[model samples]
Target: MKEVPASGAFRQLEPGPIVLVTTSYRGKPNIMTMGFHMMIQHAPPLIGCVIGPWDHSYSALRATGECVIAIPTIDLAETVVDIGNCSGDTVDKFERFGLTQQPAGSVAAPLIKECLANIECRVVDVVEHHSLFILEAERLWIDNDHREWRTLHHRGDGVFAADGNVLDLCDRMVKWRHFPR
Candidate 1:
Protein backbone atom coordinates (compact mmCIF):
# COMPACT_ATOMS: atom_id res chain seq x y z
CA MET A 1 0.00 0.00 0.00
CA LYS A 2 1.10 3.57 -0.65
CA GLU A 3 0.43 6.69 1.37
CA VAL A 4 -1.29 9.73 -0.12
CA PRO A 5 -2.22 13.19 1.12
CA ALA A 6 -5.51 13.41 2.93
CA SER A 7 -6.25 17.08 2.38
CA GLY A 8 -7.07 16.75 -1.30
CA ALA A 9 -8.54 13.26 -1.32
CA PHE A 10 -11.96 14.46 -2.43
CA ARG A 11 -10.56 15.81 -5.67
CA GLN A 12 -10.46 12.34 -7.20
CA LEU A 13 -12.59 10.42 -4.74
CA GLU A 14 -15.73 12.52 -5.19
CA PRO A 15 -18.42 10.64 -7.05
CA GLY A 16 -21.84 11.28 -8.63
CA PRO A 17 -22.82 12.87 -11.92
CA ILE A 18 -22.25 16.58 -12.37
CA VAL A 19 -25.63 18.31 -12.11
CA LEU A 20 -27.21 21.61 -13.00
CA VAL A 21 -28.89 23.18 -9.97
CA THR A 22 -31.64 25.60 -10.95
CA THR A 23 -33.19 27.97 -8.47
CA SER A 24 -35.79 30.66 -9.02
CA TYR A 25 -36.51 33.82 -7.07
CA ARG A 26 -39.70 35.73 -7.83
CA GLY A 27 -39.90 35.49 -11.62
CA LYS A 28 -36.18 35.16 -12.34
CA PRO A 29 -34.52 31.82 -12.84
CA ASN A 30 -30.87 30.92 -12.47
CA ILE A 31 -28.83 27.82 -13.18
CA MET A 32 -25.48 26.75 -11.84
CA THR A 33 -23.26 23.72 -12.32
CA MET A 34 -22.75 21.60 -9.25
CA GLY A 35 -20.48 18.61 -8.62
CA PHE A 36 -20.36 18.46 -4.82
CA HIS A 37 -23.53 16.61 -4.14
CA MET A 38 -24.74 13.24 -2.88
CA MET A 39 -27.81 11.26 -1.94
CA ILE A 40 -28.31 11.07 1.80
CA GLN A 41 -31.34 8.83 1.94
CA HIS A 42 -33.53 6.58 -0.16
CA ALA A 43 -37.06 6.73 1.26
CA PRO A 44 -38.63 10.09 0.59
CA PRO A 45 -35.41 10.79 -1.29
CA LEU A 46 -33.10 13.11 0.60
CA ILE A 47 -30.09 14.76 -1.03
CA GLY A 48 -27.22 16.91 0.22
CA CYS A 49 -25.62 19.58 -1.91
CA VAL A 50 -23.05 22.22 -1.12
CA ILE A 51 -23.44 25.66 -2.59
CA GLY A 52 -20.86 28.10 -1.39
CA PRO A 53 -22.14 31.39 0.00
CA TRP A 54 -20.25 33.28 -2.66
CA ASP A 55 -22.03 31.61 -5.53
CA HIS A 56 -24.49 33.90 -7.28
CA SER A 57 -27.25 31.32 -6.98
CA TYR A 58 -26.84 31.06 -3.22
CA SER A 59 -29.24 33.83 -2.26
CA ALA A 60 -32.02 32.63 -4.51
CA LEU A 61 -31.61 29.09 -3.26
CA ARG A 62 -31.65 30.21 0.35
CA ALA A 63 -34.66 32.48 0.02
CA THR A 64 -36.74 30.11 -2.09
CA GLY A 65 -35.61 26.91 -0.39
CA GLU A 66 -36.28 24.99 -3.57
CA CYS A 67 -34.31 23.85 -6.57
CA VAL A 68 -34.22 21.48 -9.49
CA ILE A 69 -31.18 19.27 -9.73
CA ALA A 70 -30.88 18.19 -13.34
CA ILE A 71 -28.58 15.42 -14.48
CA PRO A 72 -27.06 16.05 -17.86
CA THR A 73 -25.49 13.34 -19.99
CA ILE A 74 -22.01 13.50 -21.47
CA ASP A 75 -23.50 15.14 -24.54
CA LEU A 76 -23.70 18.32 -22.47
CA ALA A 77 -20.13 18.28 -21.17
CA GLU A 78 -19.05 21.44 -22.96
CA THR A 79 -22.17 23.38 -22.02
CA VAL A 80 -21.78 22.27 -18.43
CA VAL A 81 -18.29 23.71 -18.32
CA ASP A 82 -19.48 26.91 -19.91
CA ILE A 83 -22.25 27.30 -17.34
CA GLY A 84 -19.80 26.77 -14.51
CA ASN A 85 -17.33 29.26 -15.93
CA CYS A 86 -19.64 32.22 -15.54
CA SER A 87 -21.58 33.70 -12.67
CA GLY A 88 -25.36 33.70 -12.79
CA ASP A 89 -25.31 37.09 -11.08
CA THR A 90 -25.10 38.94 -14.36
CA VAL A 91 -25.99 36.27 -16.84
CA ASP A 92 -29.05 34.30 -17.81
CA LYS A 93 -27.43 30.90 -18.08
CA PHE A 94 -30.34 29.23 -19.84
CA GLU A 95 -30.25 31.76 -22.64
CA ARG A 96 -26.46 32.00 -22.64
CA PHE A 97 -26.00 28.26 -23.01
CA GLY A 98 -28.99 27.72 -25.27
CA LEU A 99 -30.69 25.47 -22.74
CA THR A 100 -34.40 24.95 -22.53
CA GLN A 101 -36.34 25.48 -19.30
CA GLN A 102 -39.37 23.36 -18.63
CA PRO A 103 -41.78 23.84 -15.70
CA ALA A 104 -41.30 21.49 -12.79
CA GLY A 105 -44.17 19.62 -11.18
CA SER A 106 -43.54 20.59 -7.57
CA VAL A 107 -41.10 23.46 -7.53
CA ALA A 108 -40.77 26.95 -8.90
CA ALA A 109 -37.33 26.12 -10.23
CA PRO A 110 -37.59 24.93 -13.79
CA LEU A 111 -36.25 21.65 -15.06
CA ILE A 112 -33.56 21.70 -17.67
CA LYS A 113 -35.17 20.22 -20.77
CA GLU A 114 -32.05 18.74 -22.30
CA CYS A 115 -30.92 16.89 -19.21
CA LEU A 116 -31.32 13.16 -18.74
CA ALA A 117 -33.12 13.58 -15.43
CA ASN A 118 -34.46 16.36 -13.24
CA ILE A 119 -35.11 16.02 -9.54
CA GLU A 120 -37.25 18.73 -7.94
CA CYS A 121 -36.23 19.44 -4.36
CA ARG A 122 -37.10 21.58 -1.37
CA VAL A 123 -34.55 22.40 1.31
CA VAL A 124 -35.38 20.60 4.49
CA ASP A 125 -32.37 21.74 6.47
CA VAL A 126 -29.25 23.78 6.20
CA VAL A 127 -25.82 23.70 7.80
CA GLU A 128 -24.80 27.32 7.59
CA HIS A 129 -21.15 26.90 8.49
CA HIS A 130 -20.71 24.27 5.82
CA SER A 131 -23.12 25.74 3.30
CA LEU A 132 -24.64 22.28 3.21
CA PHE A 133 -28.26 22.17 2.14
CA ILE A 134 -30.20 19.01 2.84
CA LEU A 135 -33.08 18.59 0.44
CA GLU A 136 -36.18 16.48 0.18
CA ALA A 137 -36.81 15.36 -3.39
CA GLU A 138 -40.42 16.14 -4.18
CA ARG A 139 -40.58 15.07 -7.81
CA LEU A 140 -38.53 13.44 -10.53
CA TRP A 141 -38.54 13.42 -14.31
CA ILE A 142 -36.31 11.45 -16.62
CA ASP A 143 -35.82 10.99 -20.32
CA ASN A 144 -36.88 7.44 -21.04
CA ASP A 145 -35.08 7.42 -24.35
CA HIS A 146 -31.79 8.20 -22.61
CA ARG A 147 -31.77 5.13 -20.45
CA GLU A 148 -28.29 4.28 -21.67
CA TRP A 149 -26.95 7.79 -21.32
CA ARG A 150 -23.48 8.26 -19.86
CA THR A 151 -23.09 11.09 -17.37
CA LEU A 152 -20.03 13.24 -16.78
CA HIS A 153 -18.35 13.48 -13.38
CA HIS A 154 -15.91 16.14 -12.34
CA ARG A 155 -12.42 15.01 -11.35
CA GLY A 156 -11.16 18.20 -9.74
CA ASP A 157 -9.86 21.20 -11.62
CA GLY A 158 -11.17 21.19 -15.19
CA VAL A 159 -11.05 17.43 -15.73
CA PHE A 160 -14.04 15.11 -15.97
CA ALA A 161 -14.78 11.45 -16.57
CA ALA A 162 -17.73 9.97 -18.41
CA ASP A 163 -19.40 7.01 -16.76
CA GLY A 164 -18.56 3.79 -18.54
CA ASN A 165 -19.16 0.12 -17.94
CA VAL A 166 -21.46 -1.41 -15.38
CA LEU A 167 -21.05 -4.02 -12.69
CA ASP A 168 -23.95 -5.92 -11.25
CA LEU A 169 -23.65 -6.83 -7.57
CA CYS A 170 -27.32 -7.27 -6.80
CA ASP A 171 -26.94 -10.97 -6.23
CA ARG A 172 -24.30 -10.42 -3.59
CA MET A 173 -26.02 -7.52 -1.90
CA VAL A 174 -29.10 -7.20 0.29
CA LYS A 175 -32.22 -6.75 -1.77
CA TRP A 176 -34.57 -3.82 -1.37
CA ARG A 177 -37.68 -5.92 -1.94
CA HIS A 178 -38.84 -5.02 1.57
CA PHE A 179 -38.79 -1.33 0.70
CA PRO A 180 -41.86 0.38 -0.61
CA ARG A 181 -42.28 0.70 -4.35
Candidate 2:
Protein backbone atom coordinates (compact mmCIF):
# COMPACT_ATOMS: atom_id res chain seq x y z
CA MET A 1 0.00 0.00 0.00
CA LYS A 2 1.13 3.50 -0.75
CA GLU A 3 1.93 5.44 2.36
CA VAL A 4 0.21 8.73 3.04
CA PRO A 5 2.21 11.04 5.27
CA ALA A 6 -0.23 12.31 7.83
CA SER A 7 0.63 14.65 10.66
CA GLY A 8 -0.48 13.85 14.21
CA ALA A 9 -2.03 10.62 13.14
CA PHE A 10 -3.28 9.03 16.34
CA ARG A 11 -2.22 5.61 15.23
CA GLN A 12 -2.70 2.90 17.81
CA LEU A 13 1.03 2.19 18.14
CA GLU A 14 1.13 -1.55 18.59
CA PRO A 15 2.18 -2.27 22.14
CA GLY A 16 5.60 -3.86 21.96
CA PRO A 17 7.99 -5.15 24.55
CA ILE A 18 9.15 -1.92 26.18
CA VAL A 19 12.93 -2.19 26.23
CA LEU A 20 14.90 -0.38 28.92
CA VAL A 21 18.00 1.39 27.73
CA THR A 22 20.86 1.45 30.23
CA THR A 23 23.80 3.72 29.46
CA SER A 24 26.84 4.72 31.46
CA TYR A 25 28.15 8.26 31.31
CA ARG A 26 31.26 9.18 33.29
CA GLY A 27 30.76 6.06 35.44
CA LYS A 28 27.14 7.04 36.05
CA PRO A 29 24.35 4.81 34.79
CA ASN A 30 21.14 5.78 32.97
CA ILE A 31 18.18 3.79 31.69
CA MET A 32 15.48 4.73 29.15
CA THR A 33 12.56 3.03 27.42
CA MET A 34 12.55 2.26 23.69
CA GLY A 35 9.71 0.82 21.61
CA PHE A 36 11.09 1.73 18.21
CA HIS A 37 13.44 -1.20 17.94
CA MET A 38 13.66 -4.49 16.05
CA MET A 39 15.87 -7.49 15.34
CA ILE A 40 17.06 -7.75 11.74
CA GLN A 41 18.66 -11.18 11.76
CA HIS A 42 18.74 -14.41 13.71
CA ALA A 43 22.17 -15.94 13.08
CA PRO A 44 24.76 -13.56 14.56
CA PRO A 45 21.63 -11.49 15.25
CA LEU A 46 21.51 -7.90 14.13
CA ILE A 47 19.38 -5.36 16.02
CA GLY A 48 18.18 -1.92 14.96
CA CYS A 49 17.07 1.16 16.92
CA VAL A 50 16.12 4.64 15.76
CA ILE A 51 17.98 6.98 18.07
CA GLY A 52 17.22 10.59 17.27
CA PRO A 53 20.11 13.00 17.83
CA TRP A 54 17.91 15.53 19.62
CA ASP A 55 16.67 13.04 22.19
CA HIS A 56 18.34 12.94 25.61
CA SER A 57 18.92 9.22 25.32
CA TYR A 58 20.25 9.60 21.78
CA SER A 59 23.64 11.06 22.67
CA ALA A 60 24.08 8.55 25.47
CA LEU A 61 23.20 5.61 23.24
CA ARG A 62 25.56 6.92 20.55
CA ALA A 63 28.43 8.41 22.54
CA THR A 64 28.74 5.45 24.89
CA GLY A 65 28.52 3.10 21.89
CA GLU A 66 26.82 0.73 24.32
CA CYS A 67 23.33 0.27 25.77
CA VAL A 68 20.81 -2.31 26.99
CA ILE A 69 17.20 -2.48 25.72
CA ALA A 70 15.04 -4.42 28.19
CA ILE A 71 11.58 -5.46 27.03
CA PRO A 72 8.77 -4.66 29.44
CA THR A 73 5.11 -5.70 29.49
CA ILE A 74 1.72 -3.91 29.29
CA ASP A 75 1.70 -3.52 33.06
CA LEU A 76 4.75 -1.27 32.68
CA ALA A 77 2.83 1.32 30.67
CA GLU A 78 3.31 3.95 33.34
CA THR A 79 7.03 3.27 33.67
CA VAL A 80 7.39 3.15 29.92
CA VAL A 81 6.00 6.63 29.55
CA ASP A 82 7.93 7.82 32.58
CA ILE A 83 11.27 6.76 31.11
CA GLY A 84 10.28 7.61 27.58
CA ASN A 85 8.94 11.05 28.44
CA CYS A 86 11.67 12.31 30.79
CA SER A 87 15.26 13.09 29.93
CA GLY A 88 17.80 10.69 31.36
CA ASP A 89 20.61 13.30 31.38
CA THR A 90 19.01 15.35 34.12
CA VAL A 91 16.78 12.77 35.79
CA ASP A 92 17.63 9.36 37.19
CA LYS A 93 14.82 7.53 35.38
CA PHE A 94 15.61 4.21 37.00
CA GLU A 95 15.52 5.60 40.53
CA ARG A 96 12.64 7.96 39.84
CA PHE A 97 10.64 5.13 38.34
CA GLY A 98 11.65 2.62 41.01
CA LEU A 99 13.51 0.24 38.71
CA THR A 100 16.18 -2.17 39.85
CA GLN A 101 19.36 -2.84 37.92
CA GLN A 102 21.14 -6.10 37.12
CA PRO A 103 24.55 -6.87 35.60
CA ALA A 104 24.74 -7.25 31.85
CA GLY A 105 26.51 -10.11 30.11
CA SER A 106 28.51 -8.28 27.44
CA VAL A 107 28.39 -4.48 27.93
CA ALA A 108 28.58 -1.76 30.57
CA ALA A 109 24.84 -0.98 30.46
CA PRO A 110 22.73 -2.61 33.15
CA LEU A 111 19.48 -4.46 32.56
CA ILE A 112 16.25 -3.57 34.29
CA LYS A 113 15.37 -6.18 36.93
CA GLU A 114 11.63 -6.48 36.19
CA CYS A 115 11.83 -6.60 32.42
CA LEU A 116 10.37 -9.55 30.57
CA ALA A 117 13.28 -9.71 28.15
CA ASN A 118 16.68 -8.05 27.74
CA ILE A 119 18.93 -7.41 24.76
CA GLU A 120 22.55 -6.36 25.21
CA CYS A 121 23.68 -4.47 22.14
CA ARG A 122 26.91 -2.94 20.84
CA VAL A 123 26.75 -0.23 18.19
CA VAL A 124 27.84 -1.26 14.70
CA ASP A 125 26.42 1.50 12.45
CA VAL A 126 24.66 4.86 12.39
CA VAL A 127 22.50 6.34 9.64
CA GLU A 128 21.10 9.82 9.17
CA HIS A 129 18.07 10.27 6.95
CA HIS A 130 15.85 13.35 6.95
CA SER A 131 16.50 14.37 10.54
CA LEU A 132 16.25 10.83 11.92
CA PHE A 133 19.00 8.81 13.61
CA ILE A 134 19.17 5.10 12.93
CA LEU A 135 21.65 2.92 14.76
CA GLU A 136 22.37 -0.71 14.06
CA ALA A 137 22.88 -2.76 17.18
CA GLU A 138 24.77 -6.04 17.32
CA ARG A 139 22.81 -8.29 19.66
CA LEU A 140 25.21 -10.03 22.03
CA TRP A 141 22.90 -11.19 24.79
CA ILE A 142 19.15 -11.92 24.63
CA ASP A 143 17.00 -13.23 27.47
CA ASN A 144 13.29 -14.01 27.12
CA ASP A 145 12.14 -15.47 30.42
CA HIS A 146 8.56 -14.19 30.56
CA ARG A 147 6.32 -17.17 29.77
CA GLU A 148 3.43 -15.03 28.53
CA TRP A 149 4.92 -12.10 26.66
CA ARG A 150 3.38 -9.59 24.23
CA THR A 151 5.12 -7.38 21.69
CA LEU A 152 4.61 -3.64 21.28
CA HIS A 153 4.33 -2.50 17.69
CA HIS A 154 3.77 1.16 16.83
CA ARG A 155 0.28 2.06 15.66
CA GLY A 156 0.67 5.86 15.63
CA ASP A 157 0.38 8.71 18.13
CA GLY A 158 0.92 7.76 21.81
CA VAL A 159 -1.42 4.82 21.56
CA PHE A 160 0.24 1.39 21.71
CA ALA A 161 -2.16 -1.53 21.34
CA ALA A 162 -0.83 -4.70 22.91
CA ASP A 163 -0.31 -7.65 20.56
CA GLY A 164 -2.93 -10.31 21.30
CA ASN A 165 -4.86 -13.06 19.52
CA VAL A 166 -2.37 -14.86 17.29
CA LEU A 167 -3.05 -15.04 13.59
CA ASP A 168 -1.74 -17.18 10.72
CA LEU A 169 -1.76 -15.92 7.15
CA CYS A 170 -1.36 -17.49 3.74
CA ASP A 171 -1.56 -15.78 0.33
CA ARG A 172 -3.43 -12.50 0.54
CA MET A 173 -4.42 -9.41 -1.43
CA VAL A 174 -6.42 -6.30 -0.66
CA LYS A 175 -7.09 -2.82 -1.92
CA TRP A 176 -4.98 -0.25 -0.11
CA ARG A 177 -7.80 2.11 0.82
CA HIS A 178 -10.04 -0.74 1.88
CA PHE A 179 -7.35 -2.55 3.88
CA PRO A 180 -7.41 -2.09 7.64
CA ARG A 181 -4.77 0.17 9.06
Full-model lDDT for every candidate: 0.90, 0.67
lDDT of 1: 0.90
Backbone clashes counted, model 2: 15
lDDT of 1 by residue, 92-143 (tens): 8989899999999989999998999999999999999999999999998989
Tens digit of per-residue lDDT, candidate 2, span 30-55: 87666666666654657767766767
Q: Which residues of candidate 2, in runs, are more than 4 Å off?
A: 1-16, 129-148, 167-181
| Structural similarity to truth (TM-score) of each candidate | 0.94, 0.73
For candidate 1, give the lDDT of residue 160.
Answer: 91
Error of 2 at 164 (Å): 1.5
lDDT of 2: 0.67
Name the top TM-score candidate: 1
Q: Where is model 1 more than 4 Å wrong at Cα?
A: 179-181
